[model samples]
Target chain A: MDLQTLTYIVVGFTFALYIGIAFWARAGTTGEFYAAGRGVHPVANGMATAADWMSAASFISMAGLIAFNGYGASVFLMGWTGGYVLLALLLAPYLRKFGKFTVPEFIGDRYYSRTARIVAVICLILASVTYVIGQMKGIGVAFSRFLETDYDTGLFIGMGIVFIYAVMGGMKGITYTQIAQYCVLIFAYTVPAVFVSLNITGNPIPQMGIGSTMADGSGTFMLDKLDQVVTDLGFKEYTTQVMGSKLNMFVYTLSLMIGTAGLPHVIIRFFTVPKVKDARSSAGWALVFIAILYTTAPAVGSMARLNLMNTIQTGEVGTVEGNIEIANVPQWMLNWEKTGLLQWEDKNGDGRIQYYNDKNAEFVAKAEAWGWKGNEMTKVDRDIMVLANPEIAKLPNWVIALVVAGGLAAALSTAAGLLLAIASSISHDLLKGVFMPDISEKNELMAGRIAMAGAIGLAGYFGLHPPDFAAGTVAIAFGLAASSIFPVLMMGIFYKKMNRAGAIWGMISGIGVTMLYVFQHKGIMFVPGTSFLGDMGPNWFLGISPNAFGAVGALVNFAVATVVSKVTAPPPDHIQHLVEDIRVPKGAGAASDH
Target chain B: MNKTAEQYWKANIRLVSILLVIWFACSFLFGIILVEPLNTIKIGGVGLGFWFAQNGSIYTFLVLIYVYTKRMNALDVEFDVHED
Candidate 1:
């Protein structure tokens, strides 16, 4: 079958599978709606969490970002995974023991203040809404590219899929559907990787292949060969390029770590497990599943970069005949070029595509002597690397179709998870917890579904008309979660004396400073031309980008909360006892409405 | 809090602290701060630092969580606080 038809069939099959699972797992009660009846097995919850956590960014963009950034992108690999340690060790068990439906409920009950819960709700909404917009956009992009449809039609379809599963089955449906999604995405991701690895290094495992010698009898290690090839083209060596100062990378990694732990969507998954011990082990399983993709990603990135360079520089660098002739450009390049993500121009009218680091001033004079005008590949969007990997490697059309399905699965799974988080907070925390304390169980479940539908509508609208800061929304979401939610939750569990006033002020100040810093650098709400202080290194505080400032905000939160609690009254006696109760694992019953 | 419960909490804290230290050393120390010096050492085709940043730390994190889970479960039983 043709590529387009195969993609349609594979994607259609996966959608049918998800809708089927949704029907099989329709939630019947408030407990099922919010916490999947608190009966999910540890391994199953772990798989669901993995699917929920690995968004389109992880599945689609991470490898490409790593390819271009080289060693500097290790921040993402380490930062994203390291947070699970914190989640497993410090947060998950305690939260599971508390047996709450939503994160804000824990905050409100622990601090004995509705205001604290509201602050948490605001933080959760802000982070999750911004995060969901990115997923919605990813869905649109994947649909448009694979289905050969316009972005709007793709987004509407994605929204319809999410609505069918999320509104009907709630967390119960999302959990099972995400398990199926994890299987699809992981299979799609690794199959191409395994093939590419064998082609590149004669090893089937991508992780080991990246560390092995080249398969062409070149007697050179893959990394050594990649470093040599790119450095010869005036790019930095692939193995040791730092992102910025060591301090910046340090803070940036820390920010992402805490942010991952802080994300409400990920945290809520633990609540579905049966026991506190399961919660801890469940996080381990989640990390194991996530690490499978995370480890393979670097290999895919390095090998893809090597393949791309080898294709362009068919011969030695700095030679007249080194570049590929325009007429002989690969079919893959032509295919991607039609998507407008990969473009090339025959600079200097040489009729050859020269892909190199043209901005390297030391290489400029040499390039002139070599009769090169500039780097001919003008717009190689990093997002294209994974989507185009199979085509670039000449893998089967089925593999390519599988990748399209995988990308949609990643995007849809995460979007559903975020929408669920938003819906639960509004229904469980806002409507039932605060506005309608006397709401019937059936009425509350209905409210949760309606809220979920509304969230999907809002997310679809945002996807159709993404904001200017859509590109930067991930960083903002992470920063907000890191600065506000993670610190407060940690204090609530670990520090028995943290009072309402302290928690409230700490959240406001933490998120406040983070917002101020990000807005100053990225523009107020990312309005174009509004970043009064240009987003340059010299203007940054301590040479830290706004994205990396979350850790600092978290530190400030810890400090302010500690000091404020010292001077104010301690938490009430029963609240301190509640903390003690959560610390132990015994008598943890099913997640209750009370 | 009861004495055994206090001890259990203390033990949990101590285990977490030690694991967190290892976590920091693997990712932040070897991966970032000491990356330059560690890059001088090679494992196969990979720099030790690069391997830690991208691969080793993730493996270690997985191991740490499992270890914690086993130890804490044991502690829960010993302290008579384990769920039925």
Candidate 2:
């Protein structure tokens, strides 16, 4: 069968499976709606969390980022995974023991202040909304490319599927559906990787394949060969190019780590498990599942870069026949060109495609002597490295279809999770907890569903008309979470004396400074032409990118909160006792409504 | 708080501190700060530092969590705080 038909069938089957799971897992009460009745097994919850945490960025864009940036992109790999340690050790067990539904609920009760809860709700909404917009865009792009639908139509279809499952099943529905999604996405991701690995290095495991010698009897290590190829074309060595300065890489990694732990969508998953111990172990299992893909990514990235260079430069550089003729360009290039993500022009009036670092001044004179006008490959979106890898490697059509479904699954699962976080904070935290404490359980559940549907509508609209900062949303979302939410939650659990004033001011100042810094560099709210300081390295504070400033923001939060609490009144007696109780694992009753 | 409860909390804090130190050393120290020096030592086709940045640190994180889980569970039982 043709590729599009196979994609339709496979993607349709996965959608059918998700709807089936949603039907079977329909939640009846507010408890089930919010926390899945706290009955999910540790392993199952871990799988669900993995699916929820690994968004389209992880599945679609991370390898591509690594492929281009090389060693500098290690910040992403380490930063994202390192947060799991913090979640498991410092946060998960204590929060699970608190026995509440939403993250804001814990903050409100712990600090004994309605204002603190509202601040937390604001932080959660800001972070999650920014994160969800990226997923929605990923969904639209995947559908437009694979199903041949327009971007708007693809977004609406995606929004509709999420509305059905999320509104009907709540956390219960999302959890089970995400388990299925994890299976689909992981399988889809690894199958192509394994095939490409064996093809290139005669090894089935991609993790080992990247280190082994090439299979073409070159007798050179894969990384060694890739390093030689790119450097030959005046590009930086593939294995050791730093992204920015070392300080920026360090802070950027730290920001992403804390941000991963702080994201409300990820934190709330632990609440679905039955016990404190389960929460700790579940985080481990989640990382294990996540690691399967994370470790394989670097291999896929290095190998794909090697393959791309080899295909374009069929022979040694500086030779007459080095570049490939336009007519002989691979089918994958032609296929991706239709999507507008990959483009080429016959610059210098030559009918051959020359892909190289034209900007390298040292190589300019040499290239002029070779009759090259400029690089012919004008644009290559980093996302294509993973999305088009299977095609580039000439894998079977079915495998390509699986990749499409996998990308959709990754996007949809995380979007659903983020929407649920936003909805729950509105319904369970804002309306039920603060505004209408006397609201009926049935009414609250209805409110939650309405909020979820509304969120999906808003997300769909943004996806159809993404903002200028859509490319920078990951950094914004992570920065907000790391700066505002993570610090307050840690203090609430670990620092028993942290008063309401401390917590409230900590959140405001932390998020406030982070926003100001990011806006000054990236433009106010990421609008073009509004930035006071240009987004350049020398203009940055301490040479840190706005994305990396979250860790610094977090430090300011810790320092401010500590000083503020010292000057203000300490928490009351019962509040201190509540902190003590959460520290222990005993008497952890079922997650309860008020 | 009771004496045993305080001790259990203290033990938990100590264990977490040790694990966190290891986590920092693997990712930030070997992967970033000391990467240049460690690159002199090769592991297969790649430098030891690059391996840590992309691969080794993630593996260590996995092991650290499992170790913490097992030890913390044992502490819970010893402190009579395990959920029935």
Candidate 3:
């Protein structure tokens, strides 16, 4: 079968599987709707959590980010993975013991204040909505490229699919579907990686393949060859490039770490598992699964970069034959060109494509002497790296088709997860818990479904006009979560004396300062040209990117909460008992149906 | 709090602090702060420091969490707090 037909078949099969799972797992009660009846096995929950955690950013964009940014992008790898440690050690088990349906429920009960719960709901919505926007856009981009549809049509189709399962299944539906998604995505990710690894290094494993010597018998490491190729064209070395200041990288990594742990979607996954010990061990299993892709990512990134360079720079530098004739360009390049993601100008009236660092002044004289006008490859979207890798490596059509299915699985799974977080915060925390405390369980379930639909609609709308940082937007969500929600969750669990006043003020100031810094730099709600202070380094508070400001915001929260608590009365006795109760593993059962 | 619960909580705190320190050392210290010095050493044809940043720290994190789960479960059992 052709690539397009094969992609349709594979993608069609996966969607059918998801819809089947959704119907089979349709939730019947509020407990099942919100927490999957709190009966998910630890290993099963871990797979679901892994799928929930790795969004389109991880499946589609991260390797591309690493491909171009080189060593500097290690911050993404370390920062994203490191947060599981915090989750596993500090957060997951305790929260599981608390036996709550949503994060705000814990905050309200622990602080003994409904107002604190409302503040938490607001913060969760903000973080989750921002996070969901990226997933929606990712789904659209993946569909448009694979199915040969316009972005808007693809987005609507994506919304329709999510609406079917999310509205019907809730967490129960999402959990099982996410498990299937994890299988599809992981298989798709590693198959291409294994093929590319073997082609480049004669090794089957991606991690070891990257470290192994090149198959050409050149005795040079794969990374060394990549470094030589890019450096020959004036790009930084692949192994040694620093992203920004060392301090900035440190803060950026820290922010992502804590942010990952703090995300409401990820934290709530643990709530579905059977026991407190299961929650603790399930986190380890989730990381183990996530690491399979994380480790393969760097290998795929470096190998894809090598493959791209080899395709364009067919001849040696300073020679006419070094450039590939436009007619001789590989099929993948032409394929991506149809989507307007890859383009070449054929500058200097040359029919050959010159992909080089024309922006580097040092290479200008050499390029001018060679009669090259400028780099002909004017545009290369980084996201195409993973999607195009199989084709570039001359893999079979089925393999290429699998990649498209995998990409869609990643985006849809994460989008559903974030939408669930947003919906639960609205329906459970805001509607039933606070406003309409007299609502029936049946009505609450209905409200949760409505909230899911509304949240998905809003996400799809924002996705149409995605903010400038389409790929990096998740980091901003992480910042908001880390700064605003994480500190409160941590304090609520660890600090018995942290009263309602302190928790409320901490969330407000944490989210307040973090959003202010981001808005001043990135714009209010990320509307372009609206940032009063430009995003340049000089405008930053301490040369930190707006994304890296979360750590500082979190510190502000910790300080303000500590100082406020010093002056405030201690939490009431039952609340203190509640904290003590969550700290142990005894008497923990299936979450109570309030 | 009961004496047993207090001690159990203290043990948990001590364990978390130690594990967090290891976490900090791997990602923040070896991976970033002391990277230059550690890069002088090589591992599997890559710089030790860069490898730590890209690969090693994640592995350590996995191990740390597994160890924590095992140790914490043991602690729960010792304190007669294990779930029924």
DockQ of candidate 1 against the true complex? 0.91
lDDT of 1 at A521: 84
How big is the positional error of residue A350 in model 1, measured in Å on the Cα after superposition? 2.4
Writing each residue's lDDT as its tens digit, candidate 3 over A366-420 gives 8889998888899887877898889999999999999999999998899888888
Q: In model 3 chain A, where is the ten-residue run with the lowest total lDDT?
A: A463-472
Regarding DockQ, does 1 or 3 come out ahead? 1
CAPRI class of candidate 2: high
TM-scores of all candidate predictions against the true structure: 0.96, 0.97, 0.98
Q: What share of the true interface contacts does candidate 2 keep?
A: 0.81
The docking category that best describes candidate 1 is high
Q: Which candidate order results from sorting by lDDT in descending order?
A: 3, 2, 1
The runs of at least 3 residues in candidate 3 whose Cα sits more than 4 Å from the true structure, single-residue gaps closed, are A468-470
lDDT for every model?
Answer: 0.88, 0.88, 0.89
lDDT for each residue of candidate 1 in A356-406, tens digit (9 for 90 to 100): 898999987788888888988998877678888888888999999999999
How well does chain A score by TM in each candidate?
A: 0.96, 0.96, 0.97
Model 2, range A96-173, lDDT digits (tens) per residue? Answer: 999899999999999999999999999999888878877877777677678565567767777887777778878898
Cα error, candidate 1, residue A584 (Å)? 0.9
**Candidate whose DockQ is highest:** 1
